[model samples]
Target: MYIIQDKRFYVCLVVACAAVFAAIILIPNWNRLERGHGASPRVLTIGPDFTRKSLAGHLVLVEGVAPHEGIEDIVSGRGTHREIALSGNLALGYRTDETWLKVEMERADFRRRNLFLWMQPSVLDHVRVYLVERHGLDAPRITEIGQIGDNDPDYLWNGVGSYLILEYKEPVSQYYDLYFNIGSTSSILLSGHIGTVEQFNNRMYASDLTVGFYISFLMTVSFIFVVLFFRSFSKNALYFALFSFMYAVNIMIPARMYELLPVAVDMNVMDIVNVQSLILLHIAGALFFRQYFELWITNEGLNSLSLWLCAMLLAMAIGAGLGGWQAIMPIELGVVAIALWLYFFEYVRQFLSGRKLSRAGLLGTGLYSVEVSTYHLILIGAVAPDGPSLSIIYLANALFILLFTLGLIEEAAVQERRNRLSLNLRLARRAEQTAVRLAREMTRELEEAKVAAEKALETERRAQAEQLRFVDVISHQLLTPVAVIKSSVASLRRSVGEAGGDDAMRLQRIETAVRRLRETIDVSLVRSRISSVGGRARKRKVVLVTELQKIVERSCRLFPSRDVTLEFDNLDLSARANIDVEMLGIAIGNLIDNALKFSDREEPVAVTVSRDGDELSIAVRDRGIGVPVDEIPKVKERYYRGSNAASYFGTGLGLDIVNQVALAHGGRLEVENAPVGGLVARLAIVGEFDPG
Candidate 1:
């Protein structure tokens, strides 16, 4: 039979593998060049205290905070004052002291809500403030702690807000000390919650490095998981690599901007390079993902959509390049939103389809999704002038990026478990098949042995029946001759008294024949009984030469007047085999009787015993009339007589008896006419001969 190995499974495996690559590499890179479009950005604000006499009444500026964690001096000013300068710029890259203040005030709403606007303790339940300051001379430090006020308001729409304050005086002398009350608070007003210091730091890095690293790791892990999980789909390694390279480039752009903008660029333009890089990476990510997922993207449709997206991005890039970062912000957000929505819809649809999913696939998809949402919210907050949406977005980015990373780890674990299960299943199935095969073979062997045993039993039954039948024939032969001889002896005595000498002589001859017959019958009877019980054959091994010699000597003793000649011409027949000595003697006794009875007294009766190869042959030849061809075939049949030999005073069962005895010893009788005009009866018996 022929079998066709199908390739569809391989194809499906390839497709599934391609999906993971798209998520990890393609999406992250596409986000790089699309302004703030690809994945969202995060900004974290830590250690804020706003009160009547603390940070609430002061205008503060911060710079040179670490990528995710560190310390920076906060200035009480309207902008980036040299006195309070942090030796670095803010996230947006605008360096003028006055402009930064305007941006913060407008965005923080410090003018509308007084210094106590975010002093609500109820809504900002988790907020705690600490202040540590250094004095001159020995640089002694002082620490102050504050808690949110109890008399704060709460609202359903406005969940929480952040405002931090601190107070300090410039050093006059080495031993002078100055201090004031500082307040940091979250109001229960418009914009939502403020997270912890750790949470805020994570969100800031999320846009610059955290989100990028998470996505890149997911892409890398997913590719590896697919390669191992489905070895057959490993050919897609190149696609994943390409996507990863693009995502790496995107992440590098943002990370470089975050570091370099503070040192080399204006504060207002700090986000320009990162935002542009994100836009470019996003476009590339989308294209690669589409290809990897085998998404339905007609050339015409893709080209058209790409042209519009490219036009918008190019315009935004030009605006930022020309130092009109504020003017391009709206257009950038609008274009980015449309492009991102399309990608989101496409991915969601594909995921919903009955696609094969690996742990990496689901993880990457989920992380990418959260990143998209965060980007949107942050973009809105970054462009908004009066709300704390920027801070809120930064906090959310941190939460989402961490969540996505955790998801990736879990998915990897799941993939490992499933792979193990599949391997175990294969091993189990192989074991079952082997067991079934062994059982079938054992059953067949048992059946064959049973059949062989039955055949041997049937053979034994047939041999037993043949023995009983031979016994019955022997009984009749003995009884009939004994009765005739007894009658002849009684008649001979009476004739001698009544008739004359002639009558007495004839009766005497009959009496002699009867006596000889009685002796032969007695021997035959004993042989038959012993052979029937299987005793004679089990007693001793009969020698072919000795048995044949005894049979010829007995034949001469019974009929001494006959010319019986025992001839041996290099006929060294001495092989030992399992046989009954008595049975052999009786069978040879009968063959010799027939040969003597049929031959003329002057004719020679020859007996020869010899071995040829692995068998022993004993021949008794007589110079008497040979059997008629048609009657010869029936000579071994019990009670059968030849037409020419019917008048002879002899039972017709002698040769049949000889045949039965020969068969019991695994020998056979063959009768044929000699060239010299006589019947030659040969017994061919297999001796215990080893050819080797």
Candidate 2:
């Protein structure tokens, strides 16, 4: 539960998080590095005029051309000389002069074959090519092969890419001479591709696949952002969607998509298309990041700078649409430099302030910054430009969107915590307000409840004391008179002296009635005590055999007519029981009395004392008419005699007292008709009843 405080767990978590970030950053760069190793060029085999494949990069660059140099000048060898350079210096770093590429096709089949020179940098302004003879000594058999740009065209206008295309009409099976002069005012980093028409189609297919993949990814991301923007109306989502759309367009333009389609647009339109989309893409990406990272709040200075960059960039985009792209190009440099420095300044400051950017944000902004610098540097003839802008822009946009999603999630969690805290604060305030008032109210109610409970307890104690007083009064006032009455009757019977006469019979009846009255009084008092809530039955180790023997002797002395028997199982064995001996004896006496009274004659009431499980059971079975099954349950109610006992005299408290005594001893009273034809009343008293 205390995981955050555990040092080892915290260390492991930090390591795991660091490892995840490392993988995200490094793995992609590794792949990029791997892909930087391009395949070696395949030699152009002299077979079909059109090979239906891309012209692999076996470039023969013609370097060191003057700014005003012509294709004719190169073929004539009249001014600056040309040297053969391969196309391997991919950076094309620091180009100060106009350059030409002379590709030598040495073998046969020059018959009506048109080899197109394709360049990928879509912003090139001029390109030229010439078909001429080697050296006949004169002005050098110079035929201009149709021209376009300063990088000319004896090369026909393939009406395709922003590249040099020379369509030639001279042919032989031997070596020929070709000359090109390439010049561009816009970022003139050119790579040459000379291939036949079938090869051109192949190149288009491959280009479409790659560019189309990127375009699809961008569009999907754009659509997703659009949906998010509509749902949440978030500025970041809107900006990101714009960023995706603009970059996707910029990417498509360089792939010569206009040429691929049958739309007949002018070269100026394509140039405007190329220039404006990239500029807008730059603006969109910056605004997206600015909103994403909350530049306004984070750093107002950077935010102002971003506004300035956006304004200037927008102006440049507009200029590109007009004829002012060249004039604004320098301003483009200043804006870029300021933006880059300010971006990094804000970025680092945010870090030092403990507000580090999310990985996606850092990666996206950093990548886009690098890409923008790379393009502009290439534009200003600073560092050499390598790789394509499309990849960098696409990746940057993706990362920025990813960062936005992560940031939104973080914000949601923070908002939830704040909301929960606010709710808790409200609850605490309510509780604080109610505490004093509710406490006073509860104290008053509890005081009243305490007084009432004390009254109840006092009432219960008085009732119990009255019950004990009643029991004492009956024991002295009632049982003594019954005993005196029995003694007087016995005295008179002794005076009459031992025979069967009317006086003897009447005295015998009086003595019997007196004895019954005494027994009933004793049972009544015992029942009262047992029925009282405060009844306390003092329990101790009552040896079963001894208690049964005393009970049998008492019963015989009390009732001289009936033959009473206590058929105790063992007298010598260690048979012991824990019980309230006085209460248990009373219960047993009541049961035996019921048995004797219910019997027809002096048929012995079998009173058996024995151990049953953890209880001592004294069973009194009588051979009289057994109690009716229907009145059995009510027979245990105080003073409720049974239907079968209509002819017999009983207080009914007898069985009730036995039942209560048994329950007080944590046992029970069981009544059942015996198998032989009798009512058996069993007083089961639970104790440490051990029968060894």
Candidate 3:
């Protein structure tokens, strides 16, 4: 059932059925068919309008060397030769002894016409034809028609095989004795045809077309296999190409196409090429099928056996050539025929066992095995009667080529489809593996990020708690000492009431030092709170001038010896805006304090409020030692002291805090050297303004 499903199975079945039917039809009357030309009589009579006649049963074969004299010696029985009657064409196997054929041709009621004699399988090494004319009581007129291997320019060639022009233009006798002396190292076949020149030419033309078409088909298939080999790099394709090309050349020898070659080919060399080409064809076919079916994998023993057989056959071919043992040809054909059947059955076994084998391969090899076996049987005289016609031979070859090529194409397509599916499956698996790996890596990275965020949040909570404790220590413990020192200095001033200059100055210095200490503590505590985690600006509506004036009064009270001046320009002093009041006050106070600490007592600290578009600028100018030009960029970094301000008694937190406040209010702080030779720090804030 599995084999029946394949279309090629039916095709092969049809061919087999046809062959069986033909055998059935011919087997019953094989004796009648075997007696070709109705059992050729003792004399072949050529009638008027005679197209062709076979010199079959009329021929008498003689072995060994005949007398060099004319046909008279043979006719008179004076030569050392034994005559044997032939029932059909001369099918003498390979022989080293010289042989001669004698036949009598009679013209009956036929007009004078040019008659020609045609001989087949032109591989004969030497041939001589002698025509003898006899009239009653007249001296026999003997003439040698043609000779092969004598290099005679007058020899007739029909373009298909050997021939001789009998030249019967004016026939003086109705009967003639034709003597043929033939010798060859190759198997000799003397199937002869006698016809007019027109008939001979017609047969030649037909033979030419058939053989030409077969050779052309072989050549085309060879070219196609060559292309396929290069495109796919398949060993089977290369082997098949070689097989096709060698087969084409092999057929040319039997068809006498070699005579058309530009240079004359010697019979010896042609024989060698013929034998070697057959061997090569066998080897190539074996290799092609071995690779096609993967026999090495499926049946290693059979594959090795095939290789050994091929090697043995190659060695035997060489020995046959060297020893001139032409008899080995039939053995070689038998061996190849057996091997073909073996491989065909192997394919059949695989197919029947449910293995994925190409049905076309089975069909092609089966048909091809039958064709080769039948052809070999015919050549070796195993077939009843003589060999089939040349047309039948050509048709068999054509059928083999067509079916074999179809099988190869089908197998190639199936293999390519299988390979493509395998490649796609591998690609899909690789893609799935890559996706799974990426997902795992992404999950790992996400888990790492989540853990890092939780750790950061815990660290922030601890830092905020520590900051609150530090602020508590500054407000209670640290500020208590400064307040006690201030109270003690006031009590001493009251106890030593209206004390003279030195004592009063000493007490006043103590009070000023205490007040400075408290201010430092307050600034440190405010910096801690403002820079703490989650610190953000809390905006409230307040009059601009009112806020600035309160900050200036506080700075002047803290530094009583330093003059602090507040000025407003380019805007209404009473304009109210939403800003962070506490943060802004702390920033302005630090700027004023820095101005008083860095400048001389005689120099006034100028605090000015101005407007530039929608921005509010609060600038503090002091004639103090300016920052180094190169160090100005680093001043805003936390705890960074400018190079020029190293001697100033202040922490680096002031300008840093001012910069942060400016950013929170959507503003910036600009620190630059004043044109009059001091540092001017300007705080610029952007806010919504309300007229007060």
lDDT by candidate, in order shown: 0.48, 0.62, 0.71
Model 3, span 1-692: residue lDDT tens: 33223334433443354344334322321222223233234888888768688776778766444446446777665767666667776655445556678887788874677787766632356678888888887777878776754234455555442343344443668887888877553444556778887887787787678768878999999999898777667787789899999998887775567777899776667767777887788888877776776732276545544565567568757866785436556556666776677677767777777887666667777777776776555444434222364444556667777877887777667767887888899999999999999988998988898889889888987887787777768676888788888889989999879957888989988987787677778767877767663468888888878887887898788778878888999878678888888888888988888787788889888888888777999999999887888888877787888877777666788888889888888999999989988889999998678743
Error of 1 at 430 (Å): 15
User: Worst 10-residue stretch by lDDT in candidate 3?
Assistant: 25-34
Q: Compared with the true structure, what per-residue lDDT tens digits does model 1 show for residues 245-290?
A: 4444445543432444446544235346545545554554444344
Which candidate wins on lDDT? 3
Q: Tens-digit lDDT track for model 2 on 605-659?
A: 8887776467667788889888788887878887899777787766778888788
Clashing pairs in 3: none
* Cα distance off (Å), candidate 3, residue 676: 48
| Model 2, runs deviating above 4 Å | 1-110, 125-184, 217-249, 253-523, 531-536, 541-544, 573-578, 611-615, 628-652, 686-692
Say which prediction, candidate 1 or candidate 2, comes out ahead on lDDT: 2
In candidate 3, position 97 carries an lDDT of 57
Alpha carbon lDDT at 268, candidate 2: 64
| TM-score computed on alpha carbons, candidate 3 | 0.59
RMSD list, candidates in order: 21.7, 12.0, 9.8
